[model samples]
Target: MSPTEPIYIADETVRALIDEQFPELAGRELGRRYTLEDQFAMRIGDDYGAIFPRLPGRDEHYARVVDLITPHVDRWTFPSSHPIATGVPGHGFPYHWTLVQWISASTAGFVPLHAESARPLGEALREVHTPSPADAPLNPRTGLGLPELEDQFSSLLAFACDRGAPENRSIDADAARAIYEEGEAASQDVSFTWTHGRLEPRAILSDQGAFAGILLWHNFGAGDPAADLGYAANLLSRDMHPHFWAGYGDVSEATAARARAFQVFAALRHIQIDDPFLMRMAWERLMELGLVHEA
Candidate 1:
């Protein structure tokens, strides 16, 4: 299949795959599909869920990511849905898929965690930011420091100003540029650590304002820990900052600056997405951070 073409696996095909490879799971209820850019997932009965890659090789990539992070799962205060079973390609399904323990919790995007919830999140992040092995996966976009990502950030920033921002919303390009430059300056002493590359609102699972579990390990790798910290910090309310920093422990001023810069870049990148909720959320985050103001 062409890489650009969207892969489709119908409900019948998933059912057949379940029956063929996971006979024990047969006849269980299948829930609605949740789609993302690189993969999609559906609830398989009450106890499990299945994730299928939308692009070729993503399944294998995810498998590798799972393997790398599994050892640390026990150390984390929060739970994660690593794969319990791997499904082979069959019945016209072109890539491998996985079955995982279904987590019954709301996501931060929906629940909007309360101030107290930031502590566990900070503690979890502190654990996750441990030094990684030499062979740890590195996603350039999320792993590299702002200096390395300048070109991409520039492109996205231009795109946001030109077409992505909401109507009548004008991003202070000069201020954005200044912040990016400051972040770049602060990111000079880069330290590599395990990072949840896309630690955003949707990836964070919560229960009634409490931190519950983390979802999606596809982007788990080694990078500047600030990227993850910045992304989460941006999602949080300003009042929660003290609690978060207390749990995560002391952070250098440079690291904090880089985190802010990364959040700006992430906001720009998210603006390019077609999802209304994501676009609005990213834009609002940017505004809240002082990158945007009244027209």
Candidate 2:
């Protein structure tokens, strides 16, 4: 497959895999598609979801991490994906896949995890951000300190400024650079913990206007907790910051600054992907932070 082209797993291929490897689920209906980028995911009837990596080696880490985390989800005050089974690469699919118990909830992309749920989000973060074991996996993209990502961040910023931004919008490179520099400098005192790695709105589930569950665990690994904090910051309004901090406990000023930088990093990704819902949110965040403005 070409680098820019996403791998396509036809419905027929999925059915064949199910029939061959998980015969018990063979005749069941395939339901909603949950994701398509880093991996391909879809619901299997009413009870389960199937996840297949778009690239090689993605599902291996996911399976291992999920195994480690499954026991904790029961006490989290919210639902999470529960592993059911695993499948090897076959039926023309090149990567491993996993079957998990599907949790039904509206993605924050549709329902918006409002500030009213900030405390729950904070509490959830505190729970998941506990110290990771020494042998815990590390994700180079989303599971490292800000300083470790400076080169990648610089490249992303340059790309966004030079080519990624939409014709109707502009990214303030100077302001973005300043925020990143501050984040890097403030991130000197790094403390590692388990993080969701990618805590964007879409990965967050909401129900009845409250935080419900977190999905997309491929990015789960040991990293700076502030990275998740920064990603979660996108969902919070200025007034909601106090509520979030109240639940998550006090953080150093440096961590807060680094979180702000991570916030900008996520906004840049929104622009790159042109995801309308998240792009709007990211734009507002940039404007609020004085990093960008109207037109």
Top candidate (lDDT): 1
RMSD from true fold, candidate 2: 2.5
Provide the TM-score for each candidate, comma-separated: 0.90, 0.89
Q: After TM-score superposition, what is the CA distance of residue 82 in candidate 1 from its true location, in Å?
A: 2.7
- lDDT by residue for model 2 over 247-285, one digit each (tens)? 899889998888888888877776566468887777777
The candidate scoring highest on TM-score is 1
Give the clashing residue pairs of candidate 2, or none: none
Instruction: Write one digit per residue (lDDT tens) for candidate 1, span 1-295.
Output: 5877678888999899888999998999999988877788889899899888887655555656657677887777678776667788899887777888889888877887888888888988898889877877884446787888899888988988787356677888889988888989984465688888877777888798788877776677888888888888766777788899898998888988888898888878778866666677788888877877556
Location of the lowest summed lDDT over 10 successive residues in candidate 2: 161-170
| Superposition error at 151 for model 1 (Å) | 2.1
User: Model-by-model lDDT, in order?
Assistant: 0.80, 0.77
> Model 1, residue 9: displacement in angstroms?
1.6
